[model samples]
Target: MAEVLFYHLDRQPLDRVLPGLLEKCLERGWRSVVQLGSEERLEAIDAHLWTWREEGFLPHGTSKDGHAAMQPVWLTAGDDNPNEATVRFVADGAGLPDPAGYQRVVMLFDGNDNDAVDRARAAWKEVKAAGHDTTYWQQSDQGRWERKG
Candidate 1:
Protein backbone atom coordinates (compact mmCIF):
# COMPACT_ATOMS: atom_id res chain seq x y z
CA MET A 1 0.00 0.00 0.00
CA ALA A 2 1.15 3.51 -0.70
CA GLU A 3 1.87 5.91 2.14
CA VAL A 4 0.60 9.45 1.68
CA LEU A 5 2.38 12.24 3.55
CA PHE A 6 1.09 15.78 3.98
CA TYR A 7 3.87 18.28 4.63
CA HIS A 8 2.74 21.59 6.07
CA LEU A 9 5.20 24.28 5.07
CA ASP A 10 4.94 27.14 7.55
CA ARG A 11 8.44 27.68 8.88
CA GLN A 12 10.11 27.37 5.49
CA PRO A 13 9.16 27.86 1.87
CA LEU A 14 8.93 24.98 -0.60
CA ASP A 15 12.18 25.94 -2.31
CA ARG A 16 14.02 25.60 0.97
CA VAL A 17 12.40 22.38 2.13
CA LEU A 18 12.07 20.47 -1.13
CA PRO A 19 15.72 19.86 -1.93
CA GLY A 20 16.35 18.02 1.31
CA LEU A 21 13.31 15.83 0.81
CA LEU A 22 14.40 15.03 -2.70
CA GLU A 23 17.85 14.20 -1.40
CA LYS A 24 16.32 11.74 1.02
CA CYS A 25 14.44 10.09 -1.82
CA LEU A 26 17.65 9.79 -3.76
CA GLU A 27 19.44 8.34 -0.75
CA ARG A 28 16.78 5.67 -0.57
CA GLY A 29 17.33 4.80 -4.24
CA TRP A 30 13.82 5.87 -5.13
CA ARG A 31 13.01 7.69 -8.32
CA SER A 32 10.78 10.75 -7.93
CA VAL A 33 8.30 12.77 -9.89
CA VAL A 34 7.47 16.33 -8.78
CA GLN A 35 4.12 17.52 -10.06
CA LEU A 36 3.53 21.25 -10.06
CA GLY A 37 0.32 23.20 -10.61
CA SER A 38 1.65 25.30 -13.45
CA GLU A 39 4.24 25.22 -16.18
CA GLU A 40 5.75 28.42 -14.83
CA ARG A 41 6.18 26.91 -11.41
CA LEU A 42 7.62 23.75 -12.94
CA GLU A 43 10.18 25.75 -14.83
CA ALA A 44 11.06 27.75 -11.75
CA ILE A 45 11.58 24.60 -9.69
CA ASP A 46 13.59 22.97 -12.43
CA ALA A 47 15.98 25.91 -12.41
CA HIS A 48 16.08 26.12 -8.64
CA LEU A 49 17.01 22.45 -8.23
CA TRP A 50 20.02 22.96 -10.43
CA THR A 51 21.51 25.56 -8.11
CA TRP A 52 19.89 24.65 -4.80
CA ARG A 53 23.30 23.51 -3.58
CA GLU A 54 26.71 24.40 -4.96
CA GLU A 55 28.30 21.03 -4.09
CA GLY A 56 25.23 18.88 -4.68
CA PHE A 57 23.26 17.86 -7.73
CA LEU A 58 19.93 16.16 -8.05
CA PRO A 59 19.54 14.44 -11.41
CA HIS A 60 16.24 15.71 -12.75
CA GLY A 61 14.61 16.64 -16.02
CA THR A 62 11.47 18.31 -17.37
CA SER A 63 9.54 17.83 -20.60
CA LYS A 64 11.68 20.45 -22.26
CA ASP A 65 14.74 18.51 -21.19
CA GLY A 66 13.34 15.22 -22.54
CA HIS A 67 14.67 11.70 -21.72
CA ALA A 68 12.19 11.16 -18.94
CA ALA A 69 12.95 7.48 -18.53
CA MET A 70 16.59 8.26 -17.86
CA GLN A 71 16.04 10.92 -15.24
CA PRO A 72 16.14 10.07 -11.54
CA VAL A 73 13.71 12.88 -10.89
CA TRP A 74 11.10 14.06 -13.35
CA LEU A 75 9.25 17.39 -13.25
CA THR A 76 5.88 17.86 -14.89
CA ALA A 77 2.56 19.64 -14.65
CA GLY A 78 0.67 16.64 -15.98
CA ASP A 79 -0.34 13.21 -14.72
CA ASP A 80 2.00 11.12 -16.80
CA ASN A 81 4.81 9.26 -15.05
CA PRO A 82 7.25 8.61 -17.84
CA ASN A 83 10.13 8.06 -15.50
CA GLU A 84 8.43 5.21 -13.64
CA ALA A 85 9.08 6.92 -10.34
CA THR A 86 8.40 5.18 -7.06
CA VAL A 87 7.50 8.42 -5.26
CA ARG A 88 5.48 11.45 -6.30
CA PHE A 89 5.68 14.92 -4.77
CA VAL A 90 2.74 17.21 -5.38
CA ALA A 91 3.19 20.93 -4.78
CA ASP A 92 1.98 24.35 -5.89
CA GLY A 93 -1.62 23.22 -5.28
CA ALA A 94 -1.42 20.58 -7.97
CA GLY A 95 -4.01 17.85 -8.17
CA LEU A 96 -3.04 14.60 -6.49
CA PRO A 97 -2.33 11.57 -8.57
CA ASP A 98 -3.51 8.05 -7.68
CA PRO A 99 -1.55 6.93 -4.64
CA ALA A 100 -1.75 3.29 -5.64
CA GLY A 101 0.67 3.91 -8.46
CA TYR A 102 3.50 4.96 -6.23
CA GLN A 103 5.30 3.66 -3.15
CA ARG A 104 4.71 7.08 -1.59
CA VAL A 105 2.76 10.25 -2.36
CA VAL A 106 3.90 13.49 -0.71
CA MET A 107 1.69 16.56 -0.63
CA LEU A 108 3.44 19.79 0.28
CA PHE A 109 1.36 22.91 0.87
CA ASP A 110 2.02 26.39 2.14
CA GLY A 111 0.61 26.49 5.67
CA ASN A 112 0.46 30.30 5.63
CA ASP A 113 -1.84 30.30 2.59
CA ASN A 114 -5.46 29.74 3.54
CA ASP A 115 -6.37 28.30 0.15
CA ALA A 116 -3.38 25.99 0.24
CA VAL A 117 -4.29 24.74 3.71
CA ASP A 118 -7.88 24.16 2.62
CA ARG A 119 -6.72 22.24 -0.40
CA ALA A 120 -4.37 20.13 1.70
CA ARG A 121 -7.17 19.28 4.09
CA ALA A 122 -9.38 18.19 1.21
CA ALA A 123 -6.55 16.16 -0.22
CA TRP A 124 -5.97 14.49 3.13
CA LYS A 125 -9.62 13.47 3.27
CA GLU A 126 -9.57 12.17 -0.26
CA VAL A 127 -6.44 10.11 0.23
CA LYS A 128 -7.57 8.79 3.57
CA ALA A 129 -10.92 7.81 2.11
CA ALA A 130 -9.10 5.87 -0.57
CA GLY A 131 -7.55 3.67 2.14
CA HIS A 132 -4.02 4.90 1.87
CA ASP A 133 -1.87 5.14 4.99
CA THR A 134 -1.69 8.89 5.63
CA THR A 135 0.29 11.13 7.95
CA TYR A 136 0.49 14.87 8.48
CA TRP A 137 3.78 16.65 9.14
CA GLN A 138 4.29 20.24 10.20
CA GLN A 139 7.56 22.11 10.14
CA SER A 140 8.90 23.27 13.49
CA ASP A 141 10.54 26.64 14.23
CA GLN A 142 13.99 25.22 13.57
CA GLY A 143 12.90 23.87 10.14
CA ARG A 144 12.46 20.31 11.23
CA TRP A 145 9.48 18.18 10.33
CA GLU A 146 7.26 17.13 13.18
CA ARG A 147 4.59 14.50 12.79
CA LYS A 148 1.27 15.96 13.88
CA GLY A 149 -1.06 13.18 12.68
Candidate 2:
Protein backbone atom coordinates (compact mmCIF):
# COMPACT_ATOMS: atom_id res chain seq x y z
CA MET A 1 0.00 0.00 0.00
CA ALA A 2 1.16 3.53 -0.75
CA GLU A 3 0.66 6.29 1.79
CA VAL A 4 0.45 9.94 0.84
CA LEU A 5 1.52 12.74 3.17
CA PHE A 6 0.75 16.37 2.46
CA TYR A 7 2.43 19.26 4.25
CA HIS A 8 0.35 22.41 4.22
CA LEU A 9 2.51 25.45 4.68
CA ASP A 10 2.86 28.76 2.93
CA ARG A 11 6.43 29.74 3.81
CA GLN A 12 8.03 26.46 4.70
CA PRO A 13 11.16 26.15 2.62
CA LEU A 14 11.65 23.07 0.43
CA ASP A 15 15.22 22.95 1.72
CA ARG A 16 13.92 22.22 5.18
CA VAL A 17 11.34 19.51 4.58
CA LEU A 18 13.22 17.55 1.94
CA PRO A 19 16.36 16.82 3.90
CA GLY A 20 14.49 15.63 6.95
CA LEU A 21 12.15 13.49 4.93
CA LEU A 22 15.03 11.94 3.00
CA GLU A 23 16.89 11.48 6.23
CA LYS A 24 13.89 9.85 7.80
CA CYS A 25 13.89 7.37 4.98
CA LEU A 26 17.57 6.80 5.55
CA GLU A 27 17.20 6.29 9.29
CA ARG A 28 15.46 3.03 8.61
CA GLY A 29 17.70 1.93 5.71
CA TRP A 30 14.84 2.02 3.24
CA ARG A 31 15.25 2.37 -0.51
CA SER A 32 13.92 5.65 -1.84
CA VAL A 33 13.48 7.24 -5.24
CA VAL A 34 13.56 11.02 -5.49
CA GLN A 35 12.07 12.50 -8.62
CA LEU A 36 11.96 16.18 -9.47
CA GLY A 37 12.33 18.69 -12.30
CA SER A 38 15.41 20.67 -13.38
CA GLU A 39 19.01 20.36 -12.28
CA GLU A 40 18.74 23.24 -9.82
CA ARG A 41 15.95 21.55 -7.88
CA LEU A 42 17.72 18.22 -8.02
CA GLU A 43 20.89 19.78 -6.70
CA ALA A 44 19.03 21.45 -3.90
CA ILE A 45 17.61 18.10 -2.79
CA ASP A 46 20.96 16.47 -3.35
CA ALA A 47 22.67 18.79 -0.90
CA HIS A 48 21.21 16.79 1.94
CA LEU A 49 20.14 13.55 0.27
CA TRP A 50 23.63 12.79 -0.92
CA THR A 51 25.09 13.55 2.48
CA TRP A 52 22.57 11.35 4.24
CA ARG A 53 23.10 8.59 1.73
CA GLU A 54 26.85 8.75 2.11
CA GLU A 55 26.43 8.59 5.86
CA GLY A 56 25.09 5.09 5.46
CA PHE A 57 21.45 5.91 4.83
CA LEU A 58 21.09 3.05 2.39
CA PRO A 59 24.39 1.49 1.53
CA HIS A 60 23.42 -0.43 -1.55
CA GLY A 61 20.45 1.74 -2.56
CA THR A 62 19.89 5.38 -3.60
CA SER A 63 20.48 5.08 -7.29
CA LYS A 64 20.97 8.28 -9.25
CA ASP A 65 20.61 6.54 -12.59
CA GLY A 66 19.11 9.40 -14.59
CA HIS A 67 20.51 12.64 -13.26
CA ALA A 68 23.20 13.77 -10.89
CA ALA A 69 21.55 12.54 -7.71
CA MET A 70 17.83 12.20 -8.40
CA GLN A 71 15.29 11.25 -11.02
CA PRO A 72 15.67 14.17 -13.44
CA VAL A 73 12.79 14.56 -15.89
CA TRP A 74 11.99 17.42 -18.21
CA LEU A 75 8.54 18.80 -19.07
CA THR A 76 7.40 19.49 -22.59
CA ALA A 77 4.19 20.93 -24.01
CA GLY A 78 3.56 20.32 -27.72
CA ASP A 79 4.74 18.08 -30.51
CA ASP A 80 8.41 18.29 -31.44
CA ASN A 81 9.08 20.38 -28.39
CA PRO A 82 12.58 20.69 -26.98
CA ASN A 83 12.64 17.44 -25.00
CA GLU A 84 9.75 15.53 -23.49
CA ALA A 85 6.21 16.68 -22.69
CA THR A 86 5.99 15.39 -19.17
CA VAL A 87 3.19 13.08 -18.08
CA ARG A 88 0.79 14.62 -20.56
CA PHE A 89 3.53 15.27 -23.07
CA VAL A 90 3.58 11.63 -24.30
CA ALA A 91 7.36 11.51 -24.06
CA ASP A 92 9.92 9.59 -22.07
CA GLY A 93 9.52 11.68 -18.93
CA ALA A 94 6.64 9.72 -17.50
CA GLY A 95 5.71 9.60 -13.85
CA LEU A 96 5.74 6.56 -11.62
CA PRO A 97 3.31 3.74 -12.29
CA ASP A 98 3.68 1.34 -9.35
CA PRO A 99 5.25 2.90 -6.28
CA ALA A 100 4.62 -0.35 -4.40
CA GLY A 101 8.08 -1.77 -5.03
CA TYR A 102 9.83 1.00 -3.19
CA GLN A 103 9.38 2.25 0.33
CA ARG A 104 8.64 5.81 -0.75
CA VAL A 105 8.59 7.84 -3.93
CA VAL A 106 8.91 11.58 -3.35
CA MET A 107 8.20 13.91 -6.23
CA LEU A 108 8.93 17.61 -6.03
CA PHE A 109 7.23 19.65 -8.69
CA ASP A 110 7.31 23.40 -9.18
CA GLY A 111 3.50 23.32 -9.16
CA ASN A 112 3.65 26.08 -11.73
CA ASP A 113 5.10 24.31 -14.77
CA ASN A 114 2.39 24.38 -17.42
CA ASP A 115 3.29 21.00 -18.86
CA ALA A 116 3.83 19.60 -15.40
CA VAL A 117 0.38 20.69 -14.29
CA ASP A 118 -1.22 18.93 -17.21
CA ARG A 119 0.91 15.85 -16.66
CA ALA A 120 -0.17 15.70 -13.06
CA ARG A 121 -3.76 15.60 -14.22
CA ALA A 122 -2.96 12.87 -16.69
CA ALA A 123 -1.12 10.92 -14.00
CA TRP A 124 -4.24 11.03 -11.87
CA LYS A 125 -6.20 9.65 -14.76
CA GLU A 126 -3.65 6.93 -15.43
CA VAL A 127 -3.70 5.91 -11.80
CA LYS A 128 -7.46 5.53 -11.78
CA ALA A 129 -7.60 3.57 -15.01
CA ALA A 130 -4.75 1.25 -14.03
CA GLY A 131 -5.54 0.92 -10.32
CA HIS A 132 -2.00 1.72 -9.25
CA ASP A 133 -1.16 2.82 -5.73
CA THR A 134 1.07 5.86 -5.69
CA THR A 135 1.33 9.32 -4.22
CA TYR A 136 0.06 11.68 -6.86
CA TRP A 137 0.04 15.47 -6.75
CA GLN A 138 -2.79 17.80 -7.57
CA GLN A 139 -1.97 21.50 -7.71
CA SER A 140 -4.10 23.90 -5.69
CA ASP A 141 -3.69 26.40 -2.85
CA GLN A 142 -1.54 23.83 -1.15
CA GLY A 143 0.18 20.84 -2.77
CA ARG A 144 -2.04 17.83 -2.27
CA TRP A 145 -0.98 14.21 -2.86
CA GLU A 146 -3.93 12.23 -4.20
CA ARG A 147 -3.40 8.49 -4.00
CA LYS A 148 -4.38 6.39 -6.99
CA GLY A 149 -7.11 3.77 -6.73
lDDT of each: 0.93, 0.40
TM-score against native, each model: 0.97, 0.45
- Alpha carbon lDDT of residue 102, candidate 1? 96
Best by TM-score: 1
User: What is the alpha-carbon lDDT for the whole of candidate 1?
Assistant: 0.93
Indicate the worst ten consecutive residues by lDDT in candidate 1: 137-146
Q: Worst lDDT window (10 residues) for model 2?
A: 80-89
Backbone clashes, each candidate: 0, 2
Which candidate leads the pack in lDDT?
1
lDDT per residue (tens digit) for residues 104-126 in model 1: 99999998999999999998999
